[model samples]
Structure formats: C-alpha cells, structure tokens
Target: MTQVPTGETVTAAEFRLFKTRSFSRHFNRTLHISVYEIHRDHSNRQPELTLLDHESIQAGDEGWLVFDVTAASNHWLLNAKYNAGLRLYVENDEGQSIDPSLAGILGRRAPRSKQPFMVTFFQANRNQIRSTRAVKQLKKRQQKKHSDLPHPNKLPGVFDHVHVPDGRQVCKRHELYVSFRDLGWLDWVIAPQGYSAFYCEGECSFPLDSCMNATNHAILQSLVHLMKPESVPKACCAPTKLSATSVLYYDNNNNVILKKHRNMVVKSCGCH
Candidate 1:
C-alpha cells in the first residue's frame, strides 16, 4: 500500500451528492438524512475509523449530500502506511438505516478527475427539470467563464449552487448540474466494489428493480469505474450485518456525538 504524506492536514476531500434518482418515494418528503464513513486503517487487523455525519434535508425534488473528507482524516488516518479505507452509509431521521431504494446516489471526489462513485440513476428525472436544454445552457455559461479549458466537460460553479433560484425557500422545480472540475480529488482510499448498490453500468439501458441480480449488476458499474481498467472488484456479495457498539446521539444543542460502548467493528466488502 502507498504511504500517505504526513502533515497537520492531508488533502481534504468532499464527496458531494452530485446526483440522485429516487423511484421509490420511501424517503421522499420525510427524508432527513446523514452521510458518513465507517473507515479503517490498513493494518492486518484493520481497526475501525469513525467520523461524524454530514446532515441534509431534501431542498426540493432532489436530495443532496456534501460529505467532508477532513472529518475522516482528523486522526491522521490518511497518512497510514497501508491505504486507509471506508464505506458509505446513509441514516434517516429515526436513526434506522435506509436502503438504496430511496435514491441512487452519485458521489464525486473534490478537486480531482477521479470517476464518480455508486450511481444507477434508476428513476432519474432527466427531462423534467434536469433537461438537456438546462444542462447545455449551464455548460455554455461555464465554458465562457473557463475559456482556457481543453476538453470541456460539464462543470459545476457558484451559479449552479443556488438552492432557491427565485429567492423562494421551496421551489416548484429544482435541478443539479455539476462537472468533474468542481469535485477535485480524493484524500483517502475507496474500495469501489463495496458500494455496489449505488452504481449502474454504462451500457445498462434497462432499469432492473424486480431482478436483484440485474439491479446489482447495473449499479456495480459505478464503483467498478472508480478502479483502474485492469482491476475491477467483485460485483456481488452478501450484505453484512453490522454490529455497532456506539450510537450516534445529539446533545441538547443538536450537536452530533459518537456515544461509545465496549467494542466496535467496521467492515466493508472491499479494500480492507
């Protein structure tokens, strides 16, 4: 494993939820959620690395996640000799775990051109709000601002971050537009295959909700692309049941706290 550079702060990456497609409205309006990592060091007996959650509510029709890698690197796990690794988890307002049916999440590493992670765009609403017209308009504006760019891919800028376009707290329509440039680079290691539920194949034109195997296959493409072309991790595995010794609690001030107990173990399917 490559050694991470030692410093007061290693690179801080943000995995923001660039896009989401929600076919099942299970968490539609009632969704108040948090995204965080269950990270671990690279030792043979990999120890658990813990971090707080990035909380967000659905602003409009779309749900967004803005996860900070700095929180995961507080203990300097980023500098470990063996590559540090983590898995993503989503929790609801009630603190119960929610499945990927809620939304197919697409995560982009900040400040790097690394491939995006775990997305199906299963029931993605493309034509309605995030139409080609809107995307092109945004892209054209972005190109004008960044004229010197070589290959012009759609990039997110300050203008696209507007939650409320017309100054309304809630709007009838909402859309998200982003590019690889906006999300820079990854600070820590990620095992792409473990996040199978969140990915979809590039050639997968069919939406497979009924067939679990096909569904997993489609989404597995997202994580697979995260890895190099020569190394694609396993696409299928039985979901592991996590046993947590600590629970996430909120103080009187609504601050999140990791309430600990005796023993804790964190496991992801890949990159252990």
Candidate 2:
C-alpha cells in the first residue's frame, strides 16, 4: 500500500518485518498474519474497508518476515483512494487480533524510516513497437493530400529515422557505430569507445516478401494501400530483433561499481 507503481497492475507486493518482533510462545516463533484493504467512505467520511488476503509465516534467521499483499496493492493501483486503509490481523483458532492502522498507503503521514512499506512489483515494459499489421486504414473523405518529398529537418538516432544512402532501395540491416565519446557519455561508459549498433533502412514496396521479414498481414496491407494510397501508410523499416549490449559504467559513490545499460542495440531488421 506504500509508494507502489501506479497505472500498471501490481504483480506482487511484499511486506517485511524487520528486527525484534514476537507473537508469543503460544504459536512458537511463527505468526499468522492477514493483510486487508481499507476503503474510504465516498461521502468523505470513513467509507469502509475489506479483507484482501492473508498468510501464516515464520521469521527467518534475520528475524525478517515478508508477506504477499499483492491483492490489496493491485486494488489500490486502480483507484488508490478507493482502498484507503490498512489492517493487519493475527488470527488463530483461539481468537483473532486486529490492528487498525487507518494510517493507510504511502501518502499517509507516518514516521520517517519506521513506516511499514510495501515493496511492489510491476510488469513495467515502457518501450512498445507497433506490429507490422497495425497500420490504420482510413476512410477516403478523412484522408488528406501530402507531398512525396522528404522533410527538410533531419536528425540521426536509431531504428526507422535512420538515413538510407542512395541506391540502397531494399530494406536491410545497416552498420551504425555509436560513439559514446562523441555524445560525451565516455565518462560513464568505460569499455569500448564505440559499438556497431546496426539499424534498419530502405523501402517496403509492393509484394513485401520474406526477404524483408514482412508477415502475411503486411503483404495484404501493402496491396490494399496501392489501390488507395491516401488511406494508409506503407510499412516501415525497423528492427525486428534486438540484443543487449554490455557496457562498463561507474557508479562512484566513494567506491566504484559497474553497471550495464542493455537497451541500445538492435540485432536485426524488418519491414514493420
């Protein structure tokens, strides 16, 4: 319920208990803990709260106990204020003990460094590529006229925006060496001064074949576009395969540490 990733569904939530905490000799060294969600009153009073999930867990050698509060965490991610409270309970056949810390999620004012935290995991993949078959087919009236000439302003970076030299008409992978020093990134990147991060180039013409790595959907889409050129865009030349690049970067905080940024290389090209 604390400082979790928003927008994305929380896949898992972990609540940890650190340092000296004991249930009693009744349950030996183990404790049965149930985590619950607290919902605020829509009328702005205390709306309500409900039980999400629970588990019985034992402490480790380090006296650490981690409980999965994912069910509650996901609900909060939807409408955070909807589930506005936290209740931890210890239940046994003898009786159930409830600890209401209406204090709630990360937004609540809790003691610094002492507040119970939720370590949430999210399926966070920010980079998204449009599939080859994802071209939009527009209506004739909605289409507008455009020139075949290229844009006057040009810049170089990666993937589709790369420049294709004259005579290279077929879509294919091209060698492109990225120089960290030229970009003033050599201070962090300590390994090779540069690497050949290939980029895709050229055109996706009619009858897009396997040579261009065009799927059947792309082939049909291209054929449809020829009859109505203003309604759809042609397929783009872009990377279909990508591989990570290992770089030595220093995180010097007194001691030096090396880290790898695995997102800057493309391994293959395709019309997509």
Candidate 3:
C-alpha cells in the first residue's frame, strides 16, 4: 500500500495498490477520498478522483478511467459526487477507479450550466401609510398570530399560494396570503390575510411559523412545487388584516412572558 501526499498526482500503479491492498475491503464499495490541488484557475480544476460504477467499465478494463466533469462546481457537482459515493456504499457494487488525469481525456464534454434565478414581476402597492409605527404594529400582530398557531411536527411547514396580479382586484393592507395545514390535522388555515400578491422563488425550510416571510415563503413554495405535494397546502390567499398582536406582558418581577402559553397547555393535557 502506498501513501500519496494530498496535493500530489496519484499514479496508476499507486491507485491500484491502494485499491487492492490498503483499501481491499472497499473493492466492491465506494470510498470518498478528497483530492487537493493548487490550480491557477479554480474553475478549470477537476476532482482528483471519482469512483466509477462497474457497469461503466469493461470486464478486463485496466486502463485509466474517464469522466465527464461538469463545468460548474457549486451544487450539481457537489450533489452528484456525494450521491455517487452513497450509491457505491449502499449498493456494494464493483466500480472503476478514475484518476484526475481522466478529466483531460473527457475534453469538451457538454458543460452543465446553472438554472437562472426565476425573475417575477408584480405590481406592489407601496403603502401610502408609511408610518413606521403602523408597520411595526402590523408586524407585531402578524408575529403574534403566527406564534399562536399550532406547532408542526415537521421542522418546516409547506404551503401553496395563487399568484394574483396587483391592482384594484387585490386589497391594500396585506402583501400575500398562504394557506397551510398543521401536521396531524386536516384543516387548512389562511395566514396573514389581505395581501396583494405572492411570488414563489424557490424552496426553504424553517423551524417556526413566525419565521415565514417573503423570501422564505417563496423558497418554501418553490420546494413544495418541486418535491412533495403533501408538504404544500391546497391553496393560499391574501388576507385583509394582520392577525397577530404585539403586547408585552410582564410579571411583578418585570420578566417578559409570551401571551400564547403552549407550555401550560402541554403540561395540563393529561396525556400521561
């Protein structure tokens, strides 16, 4: 078994020896080995090695293995390489070991470009009542409403919304309305009513309902559209009035207490 330095190029014989001897137990398995290199252009650099499925390699193939390296290194490459290793591990399949030089062999492979960020244009009625206090009060009410809602068993709650055009058709008070059902419950609730329009950009996950905002809502909506239908609610609407309240309740010692006391209810549920 040969021990190659991190940044150094791995030779064919060295890789074979490492595979057949030091890593013999991983013969029919996958090994996640990091390849480090100092490239003048990071974009052009390739992963030092990749585990090739046995099906892709011929029975007696002993030469260098090749792979079509994707141009982008951000997400696709990361996820592909990760899942490739996982597949190798879980399936316990024989595979060809590719050296970094294979990147040059598979030249001019079709470059995988990133999907463009979806741009949405909608008429947003800029609140004529730009009182910061009013906005803050509304925000506080929204927060209270969210806080009062039942907690979901899942970390993130997924929902769907109809993309409506802004104009006389929509109300002025709210920006968007999302309809979502709580976990273990079938009833769907309309959230933060009386909004103009909702733009769903991509998928997102969050722990708390109060955390749902324009950015996250868009992401969650996107994810719901992409992955799981059950995660998303049947529909969403724009509400007219903020259903949350912001009032500080304090004990004699001046300790702030949240108004909706779920802990007390849980303790008294008598489920023991």
Candidate 4:
C-alpha cells in the first residue's frame, strides 16, 4: 500500500480537467471539478479529500482535466492511506469566479442548455475603411448624376401625418444630409435647428427635437453612397437621394429666421 502524506492524501481518480482554446489562438480554456467521495478505514485516521475551488482547474495553462467515472477511482487519502471525501468547484482561465454550474455538470446533474442571447458586439479594425472600397465606387457613380436626385417637394406631405411625441406643433422641415467633414468617413448631418421627425420612406416618427436625433437615415444614405447595399436598413427603402424633411425647428425669436436666410444664401452660392 502507498503511504499517504501527513496532512492529506489525494488520488488521481477523484478529479478531472478539460481545456478549450480561442479561435485566434489568443487564449486557452480549461475546466476542473470534483467527482466523488471516498471512505476511510474504521480507525478514522485518514484525512478527508477536500475539493479545492473550481478556479484551480482554470489555472491550467494548456491541458485540463475532466473527471469521468474512470477518473473518479484515482483518489488520494487525506492524512491516512484510505479514500476521502472530495469537494469541487469550477474556474475560468483567469481563475476568478467559482462556477457552480460547472461543478453541477461535473457531478452528473443535467447540464445547463446553451442559448444564444441578443446583443450587439462592436469590433474596431484599422482596416475596416479599406475593406469598404467597393462602397466608395458606388457613391462616385451616384454623385456624377446629381441632377437626377429626387426633389423633396415631390414627396407627399407625410410630415403632417407624423405625430410629435408631445403636443408640439410642426415647425419646419430640417433637411438632414450626410457629409464627411474632416473625418475620412461620412458622418450624420446634424442641424443647428432641432429636429422633430425624420421623413423616411412614407412613415415618420416624432421627438427628433431631443439632443440625440436618429441619424439612421443619414447613415443609410452614406451606406448607399458607399454602395454597401447590405448595410442599408430595411426602413430605408426610399430612393438614395430621397429628401424627407424633419419638422422641427429652434425658435430664438428673430435670430432663427436670420439664420435661415443666411443658410439659403450659402446654399445658393454653393458655399460649404
């Protein structure tokens, strides 16, 4: 018989470890949990098999252990030469949280079902703009035929039908356009005058008067200009140059009218 250590004796069969890896080879994953208990001799001289926290398994760098029925037989006697009770938990690569579910699964209870959750994940890549070169080609073609652009007046007065969030009345149509200022990418056109609604397709929504307006329409145009047909939202079924005016305006007494006239002059002169 093998002599047990003074403080504890652990057999190889009581615990198991398993490992997984990231797709990019960036990280390694592992799981460790305890399986079963062992009885000691009638003298009770042996130490109990105290299962460490699940985090211990997660500490494995490359390989992990999975405790199966066969693995459970490998036991270490605590203090004495007999089998002992094993308690187990789970940990991740960081060995941070104690994963109880992982322990339960190892103990043979029904494993938790894996379900996909709905959340948007954003990844920033330096090459993202370069990857969108195809979109740029499409925009050039559209810009050359600017005369064919649809006039906003031709569209139905859908703005009247739009219900403002509050009892606010329809002020004026604020034209939203997409322009690439200093930024290499096209950004949403924000008006100095507040926006109450967005005129897209034939429907309109209210409360654009808030600080954070829906730039989705302008974003749709940029996407279309970039010829990224796939990125276009379904709500943006209107023509590329469709002019839907937002019915919201800021009233700084006479200052608003003077600003509007100044804008008209700038528009006529083709000034930026």
Candidates in order, TM-scores: namely 0.31, 0.37, 0.16, 0.18
Off by over 4 Å in 3: 1-202, 213-272
Among these predictions, the greatest TM-score belongs to 2
lDDT of 2 by residue, 238-259 (tens): 8888877777766655334555
lDDT tens readout by residue for model 3, 1-272: 11111232211110110111122343443433322121222357643334332223222223233221222222222343432211121122333454422211111221211111111111224311110100011121221233232322122112122222221121122223432232321222122222223332221231123223322343345334322333554123232122333223455565665453222111110000
Superior candidate under TM-score, 1 versus 4: 1
lDDT of each: 0.34, 0.51, 0.25, 0.29
In model 2, what is the error at residue 139, expressed in angstroms?
33
Q: Mind giving the per-residue lDDT tens digits that candidate 1 earns over 58-168?
A: 424443354555554444353444335455555556665666335455444321222232211111223211111111123233233322321112222111221221232
Best by lDDT: 2
Worst 10 residues of 4 by lDDT: 112-121
Off by over 4 Å in 2: 1-168, 252-255
Residue-level lDDT for 75 in candidate 4:
38
lDDT of 3: 0.25
